[model samples]
Target: MHELWFGAFLTPTAENAHTLMRQAALAEDVGLDIIGVQDHPYQPSFLDTWTLLSVLAARTQHIRFFPDVASVPLRPPAVLARAAASLDILSGGRVELGVGSGAFWDGVAAMGGPRRTPAQAVAALAEGIEVMRALWTPGGPVAFDGEHYRLDGAAPGPFPPHRIGVWVGAYKRRMLELTGRTADGWVPSSAYAAPEELAAMSAVVDRAAADAGRDPALIRRVYNVSGRFSRLAGPGFLDGPPSLWADQLAELVHLYGMSVFVMAPTEERDLKIFAEEVAPEVRAALGREQRQAAEPGTSPSATLDESSRPRLPKRDLAELSPAQRERGMHLVRVHDGLREELAEIRKGLEQVAAGRGEVAALRSLINRLTMRQNYWTLGSFCASYCRVVTTHHTIEDERMFPALRAAQASLAPVIDRLEEEHEVIAGLLTGLDAALVAMVEDPDGIDGVRDALDALAGALLSHLEYEEQELVEPLARLDLDV
Candidate 1:
């Protein structure tokens, strides 16, 4: 597995499954290390998880895919052993499975299956890991006479080429012990586990791994940081300005040893806003600071954007007198659409989070809200960028270009670059839609969605400002022709 693996957990609905695969591919395209799917039993709406992963493995060439955390009790060790082995083989050795004591109570109970106490669940998980490892090892037939499950002469053939990392998900002392003793890595749910709790869990796992004669350095302590991306309000709000957000993220970096940050933006529109408005600043600022350690003796000034870096055209659109009226109208329409869509996403998220309805219903609502927000945020900037670029194309082709060419041929090179901007922006729109579809069906897809947004925003913002600058001079000259 990568040094720090990060993935989104997704339910197994058909729409969500397909969405998750596409999102997984998109994440890989954007440099995210891993993709994760969620497993649940007896939910008529939920798809089969291992099956979904098999499909994802077929579709994605390089992205690692896994169950963020598989609830161990639902699948017996022998059965899962084969499934995981096959998936690893099919994915060309990119499958990672994280097993945990079952977390969803109602799903377990609804199947008329017995739900183990937390202690019992933890014990079962440990025994389960032993069975899986033995079955995955080709040298011997595996047998486990354990309390929760018993396997006699079980064998899963042809082991993974490398050591398959098994992650034990836990928070309690005993669970941490199980993680240290048998598993390759440890991931504790951040739902209610504080930093202090994480520190304690890390200590327990380290001690146990060492006691078991396993390399402590092989174990990874993964923590989840959940946050929202609603319209940042007030002066002191942490979400605003990339510099400020980077400063805040520094706390997570320094304290958690967090190499992977899984961001769950609160609303769909906010995701785009974050990608466009917030992500770039933070990435540039914080990413530089983190790399400073590796590149010792590097001055702070060296890290800053140098003049050699292409700057956005500093000229104002107001100087383009001939096209000012048309450009202003186009911008107003684009801005209005952005505001309306943003409001809708915000309102929907706030309602779902408020818990006004039944608890179960609220869960569904919240999931939808999160998914919707992820999609909206993933797509909004793309949509806005598309609108502006398409409008510019129409204006240029129909009116401005004709007028400019008749007046002076000197502006052709600038026009050519502006045309290139159109192609760049179109490519971004295409990529953004693929990313947005992934997150819309599965909230967990937001990890990929965020990265896409970050890349798209950087490109879109640069293109928008560049095109405007490239055209401003030509248009100013057009005022005389008009």
Candidate 2:
């Protein structure tokens, strides 16, 4: 199976031009994998998706770009293929194609694009795919004649640096079959097709692939999701905490084969929370599940025995003020980010072992966790701190643990155990950095890196859970903000 990908679905609003640029940059800064901009050329208030994407490509070094779903009627298939290939070559192969048959008929009419019925639109989409692939291929002049899209002796050149996935946005049976038979990926929006609705849709796609003698696993699944992040649980998808978002997203992956989750952000904060908090939690949970499925009785990830860990008395959150409860929830959010960091570390190690890793991934992990303190993953409140380890002691022992100890003297043992775990995790991080450098020098030393990763994962995941378990309620109960 392909690795899970997390990204943001940005709408290119004319007024939010600057915000759009900053958010694109932020996605890369926060270690997100890709960015998708909705295509709505008819909307006067929105910037052209391609123009926005080109500017973003120049602004950012990493992170990918794609039109969420281009209107096939508006963008001629041959021209669209050239544009995608040109950008992919220019951006070092960081582009993908998302095409839909047609939407907003009046807008298409205004733009001088052909208006077609649903059947004709699907037919056009199929022909458009043919025209695009023909143009993308390195061959002589291509000729095609279909019901809608037609190409007359079109020359193909300026090949993409890498293979660009042709992702189709579809919901109906005909479109789904086309996706299963011909498309490289499937793109669906949660707003239109909710998570529960996708299983049946995917079944159609799979059956079509089987009937067409194509492997269904070859077709990548992408979802354009949207929702809010609240401290309290609500009755819907992505309606609660970062953990809730992770659980729901992970479920989407396991059940419906959604490898790519490009969320439409409700707030600017949603972008950061999605990348730093939601993505990693989902990756970690999915990884844990895979490991468990592979080995039933032996699971190294479950290193800590929760039954033996120190626990403190809980309090009723209903009694606390909203602000007080929010402070505790804030800690949970920060802890979620740290958990994400560990997940990145584990993934990086696995990639290196498999000979598919990038040095950037390893460097990012080592640089952030060992060399310097990134305020977001660790804690923004400890901005003055030196590094993760330095901040851990200074922020936790000097400030956090002391406050909790002073507030509830009965919880001394739990606080002490957490502090010891912090020290343990710090040592494991130091070992991880050394292992990374050693692996760089000797390829065969990857086992050492993997060993280091297993130890760190065991220690860190257990520590974070223990810290949250003992501290979350106490933080809410106490008047102090730690």
Candidate 3:
């Protein structure tokens, strides 16, 4: 399976231009792989998707940008191909194109673009892809005549810095078939298609790819998802805590071969949590699964050691006392606060990286703070965050674990493992602190600091996910005072 990728899907509204910019910057700083903006040219309040993406590309570095799914009716294939290539070149090859057969026919006609039936739209999109690819091909004076798109002696030049992938936003059978046949990737939203429906849709795409003599794996799967961050587990999908989100997304990768998850979060806190807590946990869990699958003669069941794994309490929420449920909610809230702090630390590291010129410079003319000042600020922030995490872990070790063990003898082994993991994380945090100090002494040590942070983040996030999965139900069932 491909390495899992995570991104943010931000709304492109003219009314919140500053907010959008800040979110894009934060998405990059938090180590997200991509940033996708929705395309709806007819919406008066929304910014033009391409224009907004161009601005974002100039403002941020290292994060890929895309129009979540451009409306092909309004965006002619010829012009769209050039725009994508130009932006990809300008952004140093950090661009992917997500195009869709046109929707909202009335809006397309209002914009003086073609309005076509569903069949016509799909046909037109296939031709559009051919036209774009021809234009992108090197040493090409393309000559093509199609019912939807025609080109004669159109000299193809100004190729992209990289092979820009054309991801199709497809759902229906015809569109999915076109995606499998012509597109580089498949883009779908969970809101429009439920989890249960995904397997059927993927089967359609897979069959089409096979029919087209294409390796299905070569076509990427990118999902646009939306969910809530809550204390207690909810009935619906992704309506719970960070661990729930991680588990669900990881399952998608393992089962359906969906490798990229782009969260559409309206709240900034959700974006932070998704990037810092959820994304890391998903990566770690998937890594373990992948490694286990690679080992010869090892049964998947044996890999997890189910005998020692913590089980959810038998009682449901309705069976738990009100006070116990409240305590459980409190624990989740505490974790949420820690997640936010972790996100801040990650963002601080990104700022430090930017200040040291480890990342490409922003295309801005405004004056900014000195590199030294930025470094010092980041060091201070890291120190504070480290202290908070350490203190939180100490409290859990001294009070919560002991109380839980006393209340439920069966939880002893789980508590012991949690405590042991705490010690390991503490050591990692100390290593991070040392690295930060070294960076302070020598500015060039930013790379060392980043390496240390990556290690710490990986270990800490995995620990957090495991702790939550094992403790949330038990905490809700027992009324132990911390």
Candidate 4:
């Protein structure tokens, strides 16, 4: 599983310098992993990104820093390398390098930087990467000749204290391919690469990595995201409560394998909410997901023979209206999500003994930032997920099932069976909640949690499949407002 991270994206504006600095410190204090200050040197309102970052790094104790994609066009590659390495050393190796093939050509040209065509920009960035790497390496001297850049016997100086990750902010196909082939990580902003756009962009990176004989997994995926807080859910992404934010971010990690989330918060509350609430929830959710990933396709042991499950009379789906078919499939889709959650519970049970993993060992030694994440994951997280399942069951029992039963008399046996299973599932959820509390109280109480989760997984997954098989057609035909 990819190691997880949460960061804040602070805009380095001259007017809000102190405010942004406080946000950075607060991010560290509240257990965020990194702080990224954006680079827009040509802009009159902005303070230099590197200058602000250096000050913030000196003020804070643990949190790391990065130029949220440096404007490599203006800064020569060799000089930029030395400056980055110097900061990494001074900051005790808490620096990463985020590079971009220059955007805003007019602004770049005004800043006395070369204005290149797209192909030229790509070629220049590639060569710039080579120049930076050579400077970072502990070689005697560096000599290179290229169309865009030429380095002649440039003595490699003060090496970085740690291996800094070169994360490229990429959007275009060629740029994405460059990220896969050369960069240590890929950094994409939600503003440019929206959630719907990630999979296809990531595919480009992965394909390029494969063709270049590199392990795609080795290249980290970092996402710069922004969202708002609303009590009621909205049509757009991340436009809901902190819980919604966590769930959406967790889903990104699960589906697309992007592990690092650098939030471009619009306000200080946004930063606090993301750091205090959202990040921990994402970690906890991800722990369960990673457990499932460690052992793929794992589910609870079956308690019922699925062959004996009842099936409702079927209608030819081809004959149904498109809207009707979609309405019927809605129930099936909801059940699919439930089944996926159940599968995580079962897989997580197997690794509960090693739940804390290596982190638990160090947890006693230091209250490290990363340690706190493990604490939340192994302790407080399970109850939230359990509560979710319980709520789902409650909703169905209180609303959907009753509506279905009233809508169709023929669905009585199936509904009766389903209600019986819901009761069983509800009890299992209670047991899981109890197990979570027990595990927290006594960290070694793996057996109780395992047994509870195992029982729940078996009953829950079986029930969902049975419900889908028995009800999809009925819902299509019944056309009730369930």
Candidate 5:
């Protein structure tokens, strides 16, 4: 499967044309893959979809441009094909065609387009696909005779610079089948199709692809998602923090095979959050899952191997005294805090990377504000995190380790190993601290800080995992203070 792709779906309204263009530029700047504008040519307030896309293509350098779902009624497939190909050539293959059968009968008719039944619409779309493919092919003249469209002696030229994907915006069974059989991708909106409905819809496409002797995986699944971001989370889907969006989108990729997420944001900040926060985390989560799936004897919840080490005497939780249980709870709570802090430290590092870019034009202003605000803020947060980790380890070594060893003789070796690992982590923390200090002295030392933090993260995370695996149950069983 392809790695996840992210795009922005912006409204192509005349009133917000400038704002939309700015958002498109920002999307490219922030590393979004594509920019899609909704097509509603009949709507007086909306800009012509193709024209808007062409303009966006000219303005942005790298981002792909497409209509969210071009109305085939307003856009004849033969002409649409030529327009898409021309744009693709001009933009150096930065165009994807997202076409729909048709919608809004009254509006389409008002635009001097044919209004047909559902069956006729599907048939017309199928014929349109045929006509468009013929127009894109390198041939002398194309001749297509269908009930909906016909092209006799139509000259084909100006091929797309790349194999442009024909992603169909599909929801119905016939459209889904057509998408599986002909289209290169499937685009669906979360508003129209809920997450719970995706599995069944995907199954329809999969079966159709299989019946047509095509690999279902070859069909790229793209979802047009819209949601809210808030400091406070709600019960509804995607109405929470970026982390929740990441988790939900990752599940869609892993379970439903929806690899491309085209976010339809109402606010500008949501776009940045989607690109900077949700996208990367979803990629990371999917990467981890893929790696684990590829590895033999690996499970999602696999714990550290402790067979070689001495085993502590087993004692049921019921057998534990209330005081011992309370100690175990304390240990668990402290470990949770450490884990959360480690995550925050990593997030801070990400912020540093995101902000590390050329500021030559505003070098003076950036130096003044960044050094006084952004740099110090991150530095303080990281320093506090490091201190917390160090304190937790110190308490473990001076208090918990001795107590556990004295109570249970078999745990002595484990205590010794943990203590040794703690020393290693302490050294890593010192290195990280030095790196942060260097960053304070020289602003360009962010790279060095990143490297130091990475090293620390690897060692610290591994040590924490091993410690938790070896200590949690034993701590609960033994009469020792955490």
Candidate 6:
């Protein structure tokens, strides 16, 4: 698959936790695959990285979430491991643990610590990784002996439901070698090195992977294009447009065999437009080789839509009609946007009640904030929809209902039935949230979301239709608030 991982750079400082949740929900709607936050201590624009991630795990589904790079030298390795594991469990294994050697001096100063030398930082990082891995591996009493630290018979962890992939942020030779030997993936930020320079490090990583008896191919290569300038955009924008940028980036993939391209958009609107315009072409080009590799021996499935032209297997909302598409947009905004966030908060509380630690505790707070924001956003949508419904209902109540009541109340029974359906719609939201909580806590929770989605679709649509029936004619009779 040709996968382009993209995220918006957000922090608890500028947008706050609630904004992050809303943006994440929006990101999912716009077809972004991942969401990330930065870890910077002194920067007012930065938030506590782990806290944000743990909460994101509980809130989002399908989209991968992580810190761009967390400071390994600043925190205790065991604590980091436990936190990462909890996040993994909560996110259903969508957590990508991206770690780096240490903090920037300014960040270290902000945290009241002295910066380590490159050698010291690398040693600390390697030791931290060993400790983290040991803690995560299933079993009691894990041990690690390293130059910087030693652990004796430390009890093995609250293991993640799935293996938490380890990504090392590195650019220098030493870091690259170490990453190749141990990392599940490598994240080379644009701030660290140019793409061409990073490609040179890739060869060293391949060699180190061989030395470590690991599959070189298994180590995912990711480039974080955070501050990099691209020549791909409209006239007003700084970077280039998608087609031109894709052609340039494709050179990197074609020549250097890079795997993951994470475009961290400097501007909000630019990123959305970029994904909409560029993602498909990049996806198609990347998959061309893979598909060609499979084409010779495989029989392809049916490839036509109702019109008989070749159909793309997955299509985004942009492809749908305005009305049909709006419903999906509404559903995504409500479910991912708010309802699920509230559910994550509830789960965090449950975890805490059950005696879960810092990771679960902090996550709960983030989820609560995010969910409340979702509700506010949802309320806006509901208020708009309700205005129209209520205005229509008022006329029916004053005029039509009385006439019906004089004849037989049963004549307007459909209106009452429709009002009654609201309760069912409301109940489904609560039920769906519960299912999501279950999904986060257990492997079976995923099945719950699937079942709940089905129940919700029927319940919600019925409620909408019933409400419209009672109001549409009555609404036309008056200059409605809607």
- Residue 448 displacement in candidate 6 (angstroms): 44
Clashing pairs in 3: none
- In order, candidate lDDTs are 0.57, 0.75, 0.78, 0.76, 0.77, 0.58
Please provide, for model 2 over 336-447, each residue's C-alpha lDDT reduced to its tens digit, 9 standing for 90 to 100. Answer: 5665555454444443344334336647666434322221222222222215545655688888888888888998989877776666666665665565555555555556
**On residues 252-288, what C-alpha lDDT tens digit does candidate 5 reach at each position?**
9878788789998888888899999999888778657
Q: Is candidate 3 or candidate 5 better by lDDT?
A: 3
Model 1 Cα lDDT, one tens digit per residue, 87-133: 76555457777787887867877877558888888888878888888
Q: After superposition, how far is residue 78 of candidate 5 from its true place, in Å?
A: 0.7
lDDT of 6 by residue, 145-228 (tens): 787777888887666544567888887778888898889888887656676586688898988876775646556677766543
lDDT (Cα, 0-100) at 432 in candidate 4:
67
> 193-233, model 4: which lDDT tens digit per residue?
99999999999998897677665655789999988898988
Tell me model 5's lDDT, rounded to 2 decimals.
0.77
Residue-level lDDT tens digits of model 3 in 248-357 = 99898878889789998869888889989999898779767644533222222212222244544334443555466556656656776776577567666765675555
User: Which clashing pairs does model 5 show?
Assistant: none
| Residue-pair clashes, model 2 | 0
lDDT of 1 at 10: 46
| Regions of candidate 4 where Cα sits further than 4 Å from its true position | 293-482
Clashes of each: 7, 0, 0, 0, 0, 8
Which candidate would rank higher by lDDT, 4 or 5? 5
TM-score for each predicted model, relative to the true structure: 0.53, 0.62, 0.62, 0.62, 0.62, 0.57
Give the Å error, residue 195, model 6.
2.2
Leading candidate by lDDT: 3
- Give per-model CA RMSD: 24.0, 19.2, 22.0, 24.3, 26.4, 20.9
